[model samples]
Target: MEGVSPEPLRSELDSKSKHDTAKEDDDALKDSTEAEVTKIRLMRAFVESRDPSSKEENDLMMRRFLRARSLDVEKASAMFLKYLKWKRSFVPNGCISPSEIAEDIAQDKVFTQGLDKKGRPIVVTFAAKHFQSKNGADGFKRYVVFVLEKLCSRMPPGQEKFLAIADIKGWAYVNSDLRGYLNSLSILQDCYPERLGKMLIVHAPYMFMKIWKMIYPFIDENTKKKIVFVENKKLKSTLLEEIEESQIPDIYGGQMPLVPIQNS
Candidate 1:
């Protein structure tokens, strides 16, 4: 008892302990962030080494790949490198031009309008309007890239992903292009990892299910989870839940008119 500290000294010690704990937590967080930054730097270096001509990609883009691979530097690096290779070969010009996809552009099927409630850019595709081109699947593939690039360009600051609405109200077997669908899926999941915030497949007829079944197996598990087949009756209400009425397109019973991807 003689050596014991008084109550005021004990209270001061307790306060100091709490302060130390808080400082430790903050230091830990800072260290974690620094470590991640280092990893991103390493990933960027690896990508650039493989693709000498690669335009410098931003940290946020690298972070998307890193997160997709659970922050495993090796896996993220590999994925990012593959993307660079694909871009170099597929989009040799750096960006898909409207002229290259003139036929698909003329279809006026793809549109990008206002942002969703969460600020993600909205892309609406009329599946019925898509038909297999006589030229081949390459044109469609380029069109997909063009549309995606346009959507990415429209993304608001701090928003990295986009919302897509696939309206298949009149889609029939004649419009089916399995090759194009598969190719588009590959580009989205492999080349553009983590870029899709959500996709609503509205008015998906029973016939579409057959094609979907074949395509579903090829989709990444995470991507499959983001795909929602909106019920016909619930289309408007369900969309309103995630998108504001003002942003919804006129065809879907909302006010906004669909802006062509080339123009949007």
Candidate 2:
């Protein structure tokens, strides 16, 4: 998945350089940080100024759009409006209820797997379990949004992104649906934006590499930087770098089991 932001602008708020020393210029760093904050405030004000909804325009939600567009106010505003319009049309009820996604949820292809060391939510998807159905491409998009909403609900303060692990152990040519992947990617990268932290692909077979090459060009460079491919042998070590072993599933050499999604 990908968004519109340039690499530097995307990390302006969250990343720091390792070359910095005790003699580093504090004033310049402070100024840069202040400017980013100002942009976020301006973007929030711009959106709230044109709309009448009082849902509280905090930095967290508005930052998603700002970061999505690389902090360009005009583009970010347009993206934000487009999101609101899409949400209104796609989920007119203001929320996607369980009944709306009953069919997709029944597959149990996706589920929340607790939080990582940084407090970012971890969502696991069994790619082998996902298959294209006669219901068509829209079903996949709805399922993507449903999984997103479910993960977002578990986010607490100071957390703005989530991690995803795609278990492609049994994934094959039959399970590879390019259209579904593109549509879902568009929804997440364009409609959602800046919500993905890292996407770890575990148990990726040689055949999946060919499929990845096809999908690679569609992914944004910034988003590509967030993806990591791990061999089954090294999956545990790689995941344990960012996620605690206790929070990971037993299938990945961790103590936790694959928790079932509880119906509400």
lDDT of 1 at 216: 89
Clashing pairs in 1: none
Q: Give the per-residue lDDT digits (tens) of candidate 2, residues 122-153.
A: 87888888788557776667777777877777
lDDT value, residue 232 of candidate 1: 86
TM-score of each: 0.83, 0.82
Off by over 4 Å in 1: 1-38
lDDT of 1 by residue, 1-264 (tens): 587769978899889987775564345334346667788888888778787654456667777788678788899988888888888899998899888888998888998888899899999999999999777988899999988888888876567789999989899999999999999999998888889999999988899999999998999888988999999888899999999999998888898988888997
- What is the number of backbone collisions in each predicted candidate, taken in the order shown? 0, 0
- The count of backbone overlaps in candidate 2 is 0
- Cα RMSD to the true fold for all candidates: 14.2, 12.0
